[model samples]
Target: MDLPRITARRSEGGWELEIAGLGPAYVKRLSDVSEHGRTLMQAAGVTGSEHGVQVKVDLGDELNERVRSATQATVDAHRAQLEAAAEMRRTTMSLRGHGMTGRDIAFILGISPQRVSQLLSSHQL
Candidate 1:
């Protein structure tokens, strides 16, 4: 199940946190996020592990946003990396079928000759 998230962003002089359904605004330091979140959750009648809150905080806006963006971008990059590897594996097979040598395939694909041989051997598409 998807869990609810609490967003804490850097504000003037400190950090500001807010819950969607709750009316109160919270301001505190980074270290005390869990305690403050717990307190607010209790106040808002959000009890137990079923309703656990996910806190999204960074080291203030400038630093935090960069980290958050980089974090998500890394996930996206990893997915793209996997997809590119699969495409390369398929392309390697197609090249080998077209009477291409391992060394030639490696040079054109920018991979090692040994990698070309491995990709040629594996049929796990």
Candidate 2:
């Protein structure tokens, strides 16, 4: 099976991503992508817009679901990163609310105390 090839170019507006041989139908499928898929595409170097990032995929034969899933995995990975970050923030705040010192929280989280202070300061808690 041919893995999807990703390339990028700088445009006057922003970065544009090109997926070689991903025809119009596949492009449409990507266009109607889930939020996670969109996040993955952004991480893959496509710039975001109010509507969505504009992807430049080359025309080719029809693509299968397997290929689409392979591409969608990129988006899912990005989504997971976002979820993890949110959870970390919540956990840090919860620990702080429990009267844990910044140093203690840092020790528990295996992060630096300074980093813990920064996280607590930036957040309302």
Candidate 3:
């Protein structure tokens, strides 16, 4: 991003904005994002012609690590689903090659005959 990043931490009364070169500034809770940006700009001494800054909210180290871990778990679950689908498609093709009927393959894989037909017609599953 082109804007400078400012760290915001929850504090008594409102929040604490830590600007890189300029230490920390305390601000009362604002109603909207733009208002917060405007207040941050004034505290950081940004010129009127310049745009607003980027604010990074800090919820503490433990909470941040939990958020990251949850995000990674979601990504890993999606990847596993994709891999399982691919493996099912490969197994279906292999069974069909052994002269097995769609109905028989469906019974073996616990899926419908229509699904077996679909797997046979396309490379993706």
Candidate 4:
């Protein structure tokens, strides 16, 4: 009736687990599970060590969910900023095509000519 003991932590790339008292074989099995993106489950006698002890590891689901949500928020914010910049570029380009000079475009856009040039170059128009 031996049981494995597991402790896990969240990292920037993924989850990390430190299993105490686990044999090499069992550690390999746990590592395999993690590589395949599966949570390690607590099971008895899975390690088959001479000592009646093992270690199980997995990530905290609640924390992972929060991290995912935050990441999505950041991505959305960046997308919005890019969309706004593209819109400004379109407006400035239209005004320039109508015979406006770089200074006039900058004044109308309330930005520098360098910034307008960068945006136009990025859009390739």
Candidate 5:
């Protein structure tokens, strides 16, 4: 049977993690955690927090390399999403500039007219 892969990302205080096929979680660095929480995180490799558990993964060189690769992939995916959204907005503005109505843009873009209006209002374009 196949299981979901866990992705790790570097965040402000620590790491954000997402389990494939499941929801996401965040884990702060040991230094950022409270003294009591840090102790638990060290001893058990994790400690519970408001959102989820903060984790410490002490890994061998090979595992560290794998984690780094996964993290990069996650970051790259997020960047791609931002780029795509920007492209979509550009295309929408171009179509509007050509005198296409919101309903026309929505039908052409396969989105609801309300969503078209929202996009226009959001970007103020």
Candidate 6:
């Protein structure tokens, strides 16, 4: 049985695997892996059962490094967004506690008064 040509590349948050020459049975097995929270592998085509399960792991160290870097960048960006949101909430609350109206808070924070009202109402602040 000839082995399938397998190639893998780093994707945004995971790996993109490509498998060629996979039979229906083998393709089902790959889908099972994904459903079970194991490594994700997708079959691109089917030729014949004589090919067995031609497997390939093409992602090397360099690709792994890039994936890791991209993941870290995404995490950092999300963290910054969360921190900014928290800061905005804190500033808004502080201003409100110091006798500021919704209009005043909105002007100080450079947001619409309606948004300020919504935030304050939702947060019960």
Superposition error at 71 for model 1 (Å) = 6.8
Candidate 3, 1-125: lDDT as tens digits: 37766677788988887766665777776334346655667765765515666667787999889988999999999999999988988999999999999999999999999999898887643
In model 5, which runs have C-alpha deviations exceeding 4 angstroms?
A: 1-56
- Candidate order by decreasing TM-score: 3, 1, 5, 6, 4, 2
lDDT string for model 4 (4-82, tens) is: 4455454554445555544222323444534322233323234533333343444478877887899999999999998
lDDT of each: 0.78, 0.59, 0.78, 0.61, 0.64, 0.61
Off by over 4 Å in 6: 1-58
Judge candidate 5 at residue 46 and give its lDDT: 37
The TM-score of candidate 5 is 0.53
Model 4 whole-model lDDT (C-alpha atoms): 0.61
Choose 3 or 5, whichever is better by lDDT.
Answer: 3
> Which 10-residue window of candidate 5 scores lowest in summed lDDT?
45-54
* Candidate 1 per-residue lDDT over residues 40-113, each given as its tens digit: 77777774525666787756668878988999999999999999988988999899889999999999999999
lDDT of 4 at 103: 82
Relative to the unseen true structure, what is the C-alpha lDDT of residue 85 in candidate 1, on a scale of 0 to 100?
80
Model 1 misplaced regions, further than 4 Å: 1-5, 19-31, 43-45, 48-51, 56-79
lDDT for position 27 in model 1: 69
Clashing residue pairs in all predictions, respectively, total: 0, 0, 0, 3, 0, 0
Candidate 6, 1-125: lDDT as tens digits: 55434454445545455554332222324333232221222233344323444444346888778978999999999999999887887788889999999999999999999988877776674
**Deviation (Å) of 77 in candidate 6:** 1.5
- Per-candidate TM-scores read 0.57, 0.46, 0.67, 0.49, 0.53, 0.53
Lowest lDDT sum, 10 consecutive residues, model 3, at 29-38
lDDT of 2 at 86: 77
| Candidate 2 lDDT tens digits, 36-103 | 34455555554442245434333333544556777899889999998987777788899999999988
lDDT of 1 at 77: 99
